[model samples]
Target: MDLAIVILNWNGKSWLEKFLPNVIEHSDESVIYVIDNASTDDSISFIETNFPNVSIVQNKTNFGFAGGYNEGLKNIQHEFYCLLNSDVEVTENWITPVAILFKHDSNIAAIQPKILDYNKKTHFEFAGAGGGLIDNLGFPYCRGRVFENIEKDNGQYNDETEIFWASGCCFFVRSKDFWTQNGFDARFFAHQEEIDLCWRLKNSNKKIFYTGKSTVYHVGGGTLNKQSPQKTFLNIRNNFSMILKNSPISTLLWLLPFRLVLDAFAGIYFGYQNGISHFWAVIRAHFSFYKQIPETIKLRQKSQISKFYQEKWLVFKNFL
Candidate 1:
């Protein structure tokens, strides 16, 4: 097969029942598989009974996004793998443009389709706007999204472009490139793991991209709410681990400290606006990041590259 679409599921039967048909209908030419993360629900039986043609890989335990995909992908052998989310509803011919792009460029290691919000189809989704880009401070934003701000889709970002990272919601990457980076770092467990993989690829001189021709509507946060404290903790902690693992030593020296300062300010804002649970999530994230730093530095030393960041201090230009 030219490609395989793998959806990582953790008790998301409702999403599969709602959106899986769209994917199968849209991606008739590709092989589709559901990787179940030891769901306590009836997700496995539902897939087996309803979508019999679809293959299923049952994990012994829940591995989150990172480890679950890593475990599931070992069984899939294809030139390209689409790591799709169960909550995403794909449009017709969604795979054609990305397949063509991948066939044309060996250097382009990854790609993300134009992701619109399933609920608000006119607006870009928060998971991945037009495409993902990281500022010098290791903060990732997208052409259609900057933090919580999601732009309305008016064909402004319709052109295909090179990007720093592809959103995990509906990500595409060469199977070889994925294995080369050792797949998603299982240590990440969940949030920002895709960015960490993309960063490692970039450090090794590979490119990631976004193509507007292929579009998928994402019902963001199927597994965890955007405001969930656990989600906040994983995002915060994993982002720091990503920077430490992939950034050059010189950049790491100053950028890491600056990032912590920015994170502190974010904590203060959350404390005032949200509540103590959210505030404590940030504190826990920072403390968790600190605990992981020594190991992260070891990973960085092992994966050291001469250059990394594309735009230095992206906070000032993008945020300020």
Candidate 2:
């Protein structure tokens, strides 16, 4: 098959049972594979019995999102690969636009479809609302989403356009480009790894894009709860590592410190709103980021674009 729709699973049997049939019905002619990340649940057995046509890739241990995909996808040879989340309900013709876009532009390394909330179909999803963008300070957001403020899907982002990053929830990428960058940085474990890969692709002059023609509804936080302090920790730590590896030294000098200051204030606010665990999560994220600095610096590419951000003061403008 030219395309492979690979779903990484970890004890998400109910999600597969609910959404996999929809994916099968809507996705035509594409080979589907469920990459099981050492799931202890009956997820693998259930897929085997219910969907005999779908392929299953079993990992020895749970490698988290980043490593799970990297490990599972090594053998699946296809021109294009869709790293789909198990919780997403796809629409018909979801693959056509993305495939056409990739064919027309060899430079287009990655693409994301219009993702709406599964619960609130009228509103864009939080993971990737109307495509992903980063600010001057390396804070990631989407066109239809800024911080926690999600915009209603009013056909405002219907045009296909270049994007800074493609959400991992429903990411499409040329197989060659994916392998060129060595898939994803497994060290990331989960959050912001897609952004890191897209940034690296951009640095290499490859393009990332979003298409409104195709749409999917994401049941966000299937594996990790959005409110979990562990999620916050991963988001914060991985984001810092991403910025450090991709940003030019000139920009990184000022941006890193500024983001650190902003994060301190954010931590306090998180504590006041969510709980003390979130505040401590931010602190722990910083410490983890510091420890990873040596390894992150070594992974930096030879060349990086100076102008990467889509906006300035995005967090302040959104929240303040």
Candidate 3:
């Protein structure tokens, strides 16, 4: 099958230079695409000078992760689409194993290769370890990771399994499935967008799988550095929106009061400590997303929400 590998980058020149050859060699004959989020650095010019064969999408402003990739997804001319980071390198066998799965089933909407730590080599990298998994609360996590905890890259989680979502850092989705979900929500600006997309696909009975046979070496959080407080804020705020925008009526109402109390306290605390403005902004964003809930509700299919929840045993993250 033809694969369109889309790498979203922002000032990732050095990392791309080192990993592009690996991607090119391993993903032979595949279309290599570099979507730059208008890095202040000369990333676009560098790509033109250094890797003339790769396709380039140069945005004038930094579009963050979702926007950069959404642009790439819209333009890809292939059956399969991969949203890989510029900081990742693939194994020689990477694409082979994952592609073979599509041969067996038409329902599999996406697949993520095992992600390993580039520096450690022997340990797992948490970014998108085995696709992506999350609790019902929109707290996006991974099968090999939970909360801030990340597992080692040992051969321990070497078996294939059904995944909640494919990692945004390095994962693939069927081109049609992606377009059907309208790709990642650009409002996400950065995090938790993958889970939202996957949940929508779940509504269509599409399976997102984790393929262990394929692997990629990743320097996790290379783009936005997920540890920054800005990153923290996005993760928290977006998690709230993801849950509000995607969860079914029963699920949302079930988690409402507690989610409300937590957000209320969180807003107050952040406001008191950070400032009233920051706190009020969070509350406003929350209400804004809540207001739009109806729009998403109308788009959902397979209201038997239990099908998605039952597999997880009715789990939701306690993190808020």
Candidate 4:
């Protein structure tokens, strides 16, 4: 099947420069497309000169991760699509193994190869986190990280199975399924969008998976620095947004009180230290859900096409 390898960049001229060559070295069954979110850094001219073979969509304004990837994916007319972070490196022709996984399981909607970070050999890239998982409260953590056990990638994790969510970093998915699911929620301009999408798939009885044989090294948070407050704000906001949009009624009912209490405490504590910016960040998160209700309702209605409720939903949710 033809695949579109969709990569998004925002002022990442250098990352694209180095990454595109290595990516082509590892996989060639797909056409590479870059969605450049208005960068003052000459990313457009650089790509035009250095990577003449690749297709680049130059956006006039920065549209964080979700919007940028959505913009790129919309233009791709391939049998399948690979949403990749420009800063990551694939270890091989990862799509072959992923296609095999898809062939074996019709229920699999998303399949993310095992992701590791190498700049620091011991630390797992928190973005994908050895296959994404979630707690009861719509709180996403990973196998390699919880409150934090984040182990060194010493080749310890090899088992592959159905998972709660696939990492968005370098995920491969059926193009039709992606568009049918309405792609990433534009409301979630950045973080937790994959988990939200996978949760919808699971709610519809589709499986999300992580495969061990395929591997890639992620640079992690290429567009926005992890420590940036904007990142924190988006993460917090999207968590609430996902809870509002995707979780089954029962799952949402169970998670609400627990998440509220914890996040409120976090908001208070962080506010005291970082002053009002940290405080307002999470408060805005809580309110962002309200701001997004019009689209949220439409999303919920669209996602109900093949909803899997009660037992199946619980069984899938219980996997975490």
Largest lDDT belongs to which candidate? 2
For model 2, the local distance difference test gives 0.93
Per-residue lDDT of model 3, residues 1-320, tens digit only? 88899888889888888888888888878899998888888778888998899999777677788877887566667889888888888888688878888878889998888888898887677788755776655467776677667787667767778888888777788898888878888877887788778888887789988888888888876766653456646766677666766676667777755776787788788777777666766677577657656764554555545566664554554333
Off by over 4 Å in 2: 305-320
User: Candidate 1, overall lDDT?
Assistant: 0.90
lDDT of 1 by residue, 1-320 (tens): 37999999998999999999989998977999999999999998998899899999988899999999999999898988999999999998888889888878889999999999999999999998899999989999999999889899999988888999999999999999999889998988999999999988987889999999989999998899988988888999999899888888778889989999999999889877888888899999999999987887767735464333324345446866
lDDT of each: 0.90, 0.93, 0.77, 0.79
Scored by lDDT, model 3 comes in at: 0.77
On a 0 to 100 scale, what is the lDDT of residue 255 in model 4?
Answer: 80
Residue 33 accuracy (lDDT) in model 4: 86
Sort by lDDT, best first: what order? 2, 1, 4, 3
N/CA/C clash count, model 4: 0
Compare candidates 1 and 4 on TM-score and give the better one: 1
**Alpha carbon deviation, residue 260, candidate 2 (Å):** 1.7
Evaluate model 2: give its TM-score.
Answer: 0.94
Candidates in order, TM-scores: namely 0.93, 0.94, 0.84, 0.89
Ranking by TM-score: 2, 1, 4, 3
Task: Give stretches of model 1 more than 4 Å off.
Answer: 301-320
Q: Please provide, for model 4 over 30-110, each residue's C-alpha lDDT reduced to its tens digit, 9 standing for 90 to 100.
A: 788888888888988988998897898877677777777777666678877889988898777677788888888777888
